[model samples]
Target: MNILQAKVLKSCLNSEEKVLYLPGNLSQFQMALILAESSKFNSFIFANKYETLARDYVNKNSSSKVKFFLTETSVADFLPIIDKVVVFFGAVTPFIINSFGKIILTCLRTRTPLYEVPHGLFQTGQNLVDNSRLINTDSFYDGVGENLPSLTNVKLSWYGENGFGYPRTVLKDAYPARVIPKFTLVTSNTNWFLYSLSDKRMFYKVLFDYAKRNSDEIFIWCPHPAELLPNTLSHSVIEFRPSNLLLYGLHNDIYFYNIESTDDLIPYCEYGISTVSTCLLDYEMHSKRVNIFNCAGVKNLIAAFNHASAFNSSKEISHNAKIINTGMLKNFDALKFDQLLSQEVSKENFIDYNYLAAYV
Candidate 1:
């Protein structure tokens, strides 16, 4: 074994190695197949260790004999115990990149074949490898899927299974919010900063503050799946729902809102708000509102307000919203803001001003 492989193996002690790989966490039902394979292979799937949905799916579907280990287990600890490795998803994420690299080297030294599923081995860009190590990778997703013998015979193809598959809903029974709306906002913790990159956590903190100010409105601050730990759900204005179905169950008038990353919540919000998020594209299929937050500097204030109020300022804001240019500040210079949020702040720190202070 190479030096890196040797190091990884030594840390694994003497346990037999078994591993599985997953491209994405959405394939929760696939755990049955993985667990079945585990009994013969001593394997584990490569995925985010902290993802709640993935773990929950496994726990509910897997037999008691199957062992589910998190990705946090060190390569050294995992390599020695795994007898076979199967990757489940298209490889992405920093954790997967590092862990998979170590595994690749070790497998090369050990002469173990790493099995890849359909679409599991494709690299969309040159980022996956350096020029020297490019030849070994394979992609099942790239094979020509449709063959057309003539102009009339040509068929257009797309990704994902679009059959009339049954939709799975998460069931939760809990006290409903005081005021439920036809449409509500749903944001996750992972992209919390996306609302306002300048002030950290301003996205959520500000939103909570706004909700408190407008407690009469039936606004829901549905926590991201991973953000609903016991400690994270403390808020007064918004009703917290652990299951998206329960949140969706409340009303059909509900609309999903996200700032940037919607890797997980895209499907839940069939009607979406489009801006920077790719998930918004999926929502466009329903022709939902795709309002853009026009003001640039107030990203922090806007994020906080959206999170707390459970209402997007964009709903009230428009391209023609009043604007005033304040003279320059010390370092960042003068700024402009919506009359609603900017009316109170000096030009110098308009963006820096706290929206929560108004709610508190």
Candidate 2:
């Protein structure tokens, strides 16, 4: 074995306590932090490109101690110390699979515990199999297994109850102020995949028409981080990039708020619109007024959210478009949800830690 591989093997043999490694996404990072604070784990490590964001979130919103590390480090340097891994999403990329693949091999050899903490949301067709397209092939596994390290498909859980029960008290304590807008357009880059060039033009055209009709209402457009605003739409409305959206200011004309994580933004908007995104479902759960546009494909995905009034075309957007409500939404009791979540947070150990033990 090479020096790095030898080192990993040695570390796996010597270390009795397991450290929890989490992805650097905001939601996952937050959940992992909570787990670390409430568990007997050795240490909580955040691993990903967004180390700065993870630090900012922990410093501002949480009191738990955490270590932030970049994902680009040498695998030998990083994976040796990690005994367990908690990911909100499946290992879908080569880099992710390779890194975790090494850890899996080490853990398997040592008979140590390792686990994947999947996102709490439920999506059809994703949970039927544990292996992703990139990692499931025999050639990929065969090459990696030569070193006696094998990658096993981590299991997934539809922890939807955990979604409703996120500690609202902690969130309220962290972010005290509320910023609400009269009308908000929740834009997504789904147009990149869901709409053709003409369809995209029509999509925005419908929004522009609606904005023109409701000139008196204060409108704010919130774009997804991956979305690029077309010049046509850019010239008409005030656009805010994700970095500058949360400074708290008032504007007269139609504007965009540049903010990361629309979780906070969606709740405050009186009315909302999006072409197909989880944010729309979030808005629905929170009882916010929102609409989904019907693109050419993704009808089944749209139906999964139980949203009604999929605008077949841009021309269908009229004044009455905002008034339509599909009662198919699943709403949680706000007080009960908060109470259950607070109870979970107050525990010495989170329920997720027990779930993690099951894999070990």
Candidate 3:
């Protein structure tokens, strides 16, 4: 830990009130900010040494009252001060398990409340094996169980039953409804597609072709924050990096809206396109029509939507555009959304505070 970081944590340790520890990624940071503004807990936003983008994002989005910290701070330094720990992606990477896992362990030892907040929507059992490979289990602390330390003794926001032992909390729809645009293309990074697809470039080609065929429609392409377009794909298709385009800004030609999470922009889009991404599930929840490109076959994608009854009710838009309609979900009520957001965490169904501490 850096000397300056230690000093920062030491200065903030005066409060006995619970501290909500959150990773500093744009998604997690946004979630933390929402929770902090609505709840009474003080938040500590942790940024990895290399996450310059994340740090900048938090600075821009967070208010003056929000606290920021370097992830290098010692777990021992946090143990005494932190009464509650909230993790976004749990043990998905070695850096995560090492940096954030220590704080979770500390919370466990101290019997502090620990909550596992999901950063993505499609975290079903089908992808657990693929996601778990990112963890370096060999480095786990002594006496830890075979399961990832972060998964044990934590409250989870799960959509379906897949057999993880943690207690589930139904995630109330938080996104507000907006006027649906003509068309939107949601892009994910090749890093994830490369895992299950043969030729990632082919995926982009198909996507570009789809966009070009529908050039007449007012089209908006929202690429993943880390998305890298392949050289083979037409450069003309993607107008600008999402950061360069103004937020919710309009363009006469094909537009690339500058935004962070696709979930944030989904409400404004009418028809959407993407491969098997969690955001598609979110779009379904919002009743937005989405086309799941079958570059990796539809088997996995079909299984993902198995729990969603609305999936079967969707009509096909094209051979590729599996236009799923999620109208089955309750209509978005602005008052209800606000109520859910501001409702006290105590009222929600969470893992027993005692069980969360010692279950592992």
Candidate 4:
């Protein structure tokens, strides 16, 4: 069958089943594939016209088991039956959120359960730990003071499920995965804000100077997807995408350092280089060598590698954040993420449908 036909068929079959709400581009969908599979509910991911890449990526990544549907209509259709709705990418703007507030208020007036699973994008900025706040069935915060609208009848749960296993680097087995040459500069996407800011130009400047002075070790720069300009890296530098970097044939004597998203870069604990970001909490759980950077919000991200020597070790941190209206889930923890999902659906209840059938 043709692609459109298949999508239609898929939707028809899953019309009465569980649905998952996701937004953003293809990459968001791709990153969410593993997590979605772990949910207790049989997922039918919804998207918008702008998210074609994400729709295709999720479909491909899950072997078409995960269904896709148009966003608003899908929301209207599924919100009643489904116990929880995860707003993965915040595709729903303030307008939608406001409208949802009304629906939720109605639900509250009638005493029904409604929840939101925000996948990162909240607050005004893009930093992992910026002006952001968690939006669930329970409470809402602007990351600082309590958001006034304080939702009711909804409980806030942690962000992820446990069945996917501890997070690990995706391309871990890639060629240059293990060998971190001394001059290696590992980085995350530059275009997106860690907290609504980009540190690429500043960090790159320091890296460029360091490379010019020490022309001995091969300087390798691994760029983030949000980062578009690796070509401008120093002429003597070796720019490698994660895929190709592993295969380029290099020797064993190497060291590694990375300027990545605080949450993302924490998985790399074996390396001794100190890092700066709230993500250090996860890393500290594994590696004791992490150094916490004290700057708050986007500014710290902009100052990249300015004083590499300033990296300092940190004690375990406790995020005393609060949420409201959560039914069972009250906080962010791995088990909670799983529990909220597992209790919702069972293996036998999941059905496979042809998404293309929806178009028919």
After superposition, the stretches of candidate 3 with alpha carbons farther than 4 Å from their true spots are 1-17, 40-43, 47-79, 97-113, 124-127, 130-152, 160-182, 193-199, 229-260, 295-298, 304-360
**What does candidate 2's lDDT look like per residue over 1-360, in tens digits?**
111223335343544444656553565665666555544555556455566766565567554555555554443466556655544444334544554544444444543444444343322223222222343322312111111111223332322443333322234334344554555645554423334556655666666666666567555565553343354333333342232122222342332454445566665666666676545545555555566667654466556544455665445554344433333333333444323322312232232233322333
Regions of candidate 2 where Cα sits further than 4 Å from its true position: 1-19, 22-43, 57-65, 70-78, 91-152, 159-181, 191-198, 229-260, 314-360
Better of 3 and 4 by TM-score: 3
Off by over 4 Å in 4: 1-17, 25-27, 49-64, 70-81, 88-183, 188-208, 214-338, 341-360
Write the number of the candidate with greater lDDT, choosing between 1 and 2.
Answer: 2
Residue 299 C-alpha lDDT in model 2: 61
> Number of the top candidate by lDDT?
3
Two-way lDDT contest, 2 vs 3, winner: 3
Q: Rank the candidates by TM-score, best first.
A: 2, 3, 4, 1
Candidates sorted on lDDT, descending: 3, 2, 4, 1
In model 2, the clashing pairs are 241-258, 245-258
Each candidate: what lDDT? 0.33, 0.46, 0.47, 0.36
- Worst lDDT window (10 residues) for model 3? 162-171
lDDT of 3 by residue, 148-229 (tens): 3344334354333322211111233544544445556554544452233343455555555554565565545555544433
Tell how far residue 308 is off in model 3, in angstroms: 8.8
Q: Model 1, range 324-359, lDDT digits (tens) per residue?
A: 111111111111101111122223332222231222
* Model 1 / residue 94 / CA error / Å: 5.1
